[model samples]
Target: MTLSDETPGGAGMHVHRLLDEAFAGVEMGPDQQDLKEEMRGNLVARVTELTATGMAEPAAARRALDELGDVRAILDATESRPGPGEAAWQPPRVRPNPAFAVRTVVLSAVAATGLLVLVLAATVVDVPLAAQIVAVAFVALAAGAITADALRQETTTNHPVPPARAAGYGTATLLATTGLGAAWLYLRDAGLPWLVAGALLVVASAVLFTYLGATQTNRHKAWVLRQQAPYGSDRFTEDPAAAARFGIYTVTVWLVAAAAFVALTLTAGWEWSWLAVVGGFVAMTVLIARMLFAPKA
Candidate 1:
C-alpha cells in the first residue's frame, strides 16, 4: 500500500512523500489511483501487524515502511501486483480529540450559564432563588448538548458531514426556537419579556454553535492546504529557519500575553486580567497576518 504524505498523521504519509519524490519525471497514468490504494493498503497492513506485536503504531508503521526500502523500488517491484479485495481495506477515521472535548465542555458551560443569567435577569430584573435554580438546570442541559456537538466536531474534521445528520441538527434547533417563539407569543401569564428573553437566548446559542462548527471546518481547510504544498516548492524560502522564526514569534506573543495577564491581575485585580489576554490575542493575530503576507526578502 502506498503511504500518503498528504494525510495528517503517520509514517504512511512519510512513505507517500518518498514515493512522490521517486515519481518525479514519471507520467501518472489511469492506474494511479489503484497504485495509491494498493500501496497504502500494504503499508497499513504491515503497520497493523507490527502494532499487534505491541509496537507503537507510529513506530511500527515507520519501521515497517523503512524495511520495505525506497518507494520507487517498491513500486517497481509491485508493478505486476494485484491488490487485495475491497473488504481488506478501509479509510482511517479521526478520533475525537480529548483535549478539545474538555475545552469545549468548559467553554460551553460558561457561555450557557452566562446566557441563562442574562435572560433571567433581563426578564425578571430580580429572579427568586427557585427561578434561578430552574434557569441553571436549563443552562446545564444546553451546555451538555453544546459539548456533545463540539466533541462530535472533533471527528467531523476527518470526514465530510452527512447531509441528513446536518439537517437533523438544523431542524432540531429550528424547532426549539420556534417552540420558544410560540410560547413568547401565546403565554401571556408567562410574562412576554421572560418568554422573549428565552427565545433570544436560544437564537444566540445557535449562532455560537454555528461559529464553533465553522472553526472546526476551517481546520480541515488547513489540512488541505498542507497537503497541497509540495515539499520542494520554494524549499529555501520555506525552510527550517522560517518555521523557527514563526515559532519564536508565537512563543514571544504568548509569553507577553501571560506577563500582561499577571501584571493586570496584580495592578487592576483579577477581573481585568482577561481583557489583557483578549488584547494579546488580537495583537498576535495581526502580527502573524503581517508575517504571512510580508513581502519576500
Candidate 2:
C-alpha cells in the first residue's frame, strides 16, 4: 500500500505523501526496508494518537509532518553503512559519562534552587525596593551566565543543540540584570515592588533554562546520531515539527505557572508565599521527567 493510505487524516495523509516524495529517490535494501517501515509506522501511530485526542486534523497532520523532519539525513545514514558490497561504516563513538551527567544534573538543580531562594528572600525581607530589584537582576544574570557556559561546552564538544532554539543567552542574562536594576528604582514602600522583582527573576530564569534545554536537546540528538548512523537512515532529523511541539509545551508550562502566580497573589496578599515556589518545583519536575523519559522521534 502507498504511504498516504496509512495516514489517518487529510493533513497526516498529505504529510505522508510529502515524506514519500522527498525520499522517493532513496534506494533501500532488504535490511533497511524494515527500519523504514518501523519509522513510518511509528509516525503514523503518533499522528493517529494526536488526531484522536481532538487535535484539529490539520494540526495533527502538521505535527506528524514535523516529527518526521530530517528524513534525508536518516536515509543517508541508513544507506551509507557497511554492507555486503560496501566498506563498513564506522560509527562515530562518544560515550556519555554517567558521573558527568549526574554531576551536571545536580549542579543545575542546585543553581536553580539557589537563584529561586535568593529571589524569594528578597521578596520576604522587606529590603529596599532597589536592593530587591538588584538581587533579582543578579539571579537572572547568573542563570544566563550558567546557560552560556553550558552552550559553550556543548558546541566545543560538537554536540547538537536542542530544538526550539533561543538566541542571545548572553543578552537574556543582561536584560534580566537590567530589569532588576530598574525594578529597584521603581518598587518602593509596602507596595508591589516584590511582585515586580519576582516577575523579573522568573522571566530571567525561564529564558536561561530554555536556552540550556535547547542546547542539551541538540547534544542528545548528536549522541543519538552517532550511535544510530551505522545502522539506519537519519531522515528524522530534517523535520522541524519536534521543535514546534517543544515550543508549545514550554508555553503551556509558562501559562500554568502564571496562573498559579496569580492565584498566589490573590490569596497570600503580597506575602512571600509558596505558590510560585511550589509551581516552579512542579514545573521543573515535569520538564525533567519528560526530557528523560519521553519517546524520541
Candidate 3:
C-alpha cells in the first residue's frame, strides 16, 4: 500500500506529513507503523517540554516535527526487524559481561568485612569516645541513604546500573552497620582492637561504595552513547571530564556533610549534629545543581 493509504486514520497526521517531507523518496506501509508510533510518542514528549519552555503550541509542534529527520532512514537504522512478518521478532541473545557483576559483589563483601572490623576496634580503643561513636553513626547513616537512593532509582526509573548492583551495595552497607552495632553492644570490653577493626570496615565500605558509584556512572554514560549513536546525534555526548567533575563534586559534598556531622557530634552532641547535617545536605544539593547546569563550552 502507498504511504497515504497506510496512514489512513490520521491518528498521527502531522507526524506523518513531517516524515513524508523528510523522507521524500522512501516507501511507507504497514511495515513502518511501529516506527511511526515510536516517532510520534517521542515528538509528543518533546513538544510537551517545549510547551513548558513557553513555546506556542503551533511553534512547539513545528519544532518537534522539524527535529525528526529522514524518517525511513531512521527506521532502517534503528529497527533490527522492521517488516510486518517480523514485527514480533526477537534478537539473538548474547551472554552478559560478568566482570562488573563480579567486581561489585567482591568489592562489596570486602568493604563490609573491613567496616565491621573497623567499627569494633573503634569501640574498644582509648580514642575520643564521642568522636568515634559519632563517626560510626555518621558512616552508617550516609551509607544507608546512598543505598536507599540507589534502590529508589532502580525501582522507580529507567536508568541503567542494574538493580543487582544496588542490592549488593545495600547489603554490604547493612552488614557493616550491623556488625558495628553488635560489637558496640556486646564486645564493649574488647577495647582498642574492636575499634580498629570497625574503623577498617568503615573505610573499606566507603571505598567499595565509591567504586560502585563510579562504575554505575560509566554504565549510564555508555547507555547514553548507544542511544544517541544510532541517531547520528551528539546532543548527549558523554564527556568524561565533565562526568569526573560531577563525581568529584558529589564526593566533596559527602565529605563536607560527614565532617559537619562529626563536628556537631563533638561540640553539640548527636541531636544538634542533625541540623548541621541537614545544612550540609542542602549545600551539597546546590553544588550538584551548579555543576549539572553550568555553561558548556
Task: List TM-score per model, in order.
Answer: 0.33, 0.30, 0.31
Model 1 Cα lDDT, one tens digit per residue, 178-283: 4454353335355566666667667765765554343332324223334444343442234435544665677688898899999999999999999878987898
For candidate 2, give the lDDT of residue 116. Answer: 60
Better of 1 and 3 by lDDT: 3
Q: Which ranges in model 1 have alpha carbons more than 4 Å from their true place?
A: 1-17, 21-66, 69-89, 93-150, 153-191, 210-226, 229-291, 294-297
**What alpha-carbon RMSD in Å does predicted model 2 have with respect to the real structure?**
16.7
Candidate 2's C-alpha runs over 4 A off are 1-127, 155-190, 193-217, 220-226, 233-297
lDDT to native, each model: 0.56, 0.55, 0.57
Instruction: Please give the ranking of all candidate structures by TM-score, highest first, separated by commas.
Output: 1, 3, 2
Which candidate ranks first by TM-score, i.e. highest? 1
- In TM-score terms, candidate 1 sits at 0.33
Candidate 2 structure, TM-score to reference: 0.30
- When sorted by lDDT, best at the front, the candidate numbers are 3, 1, 2
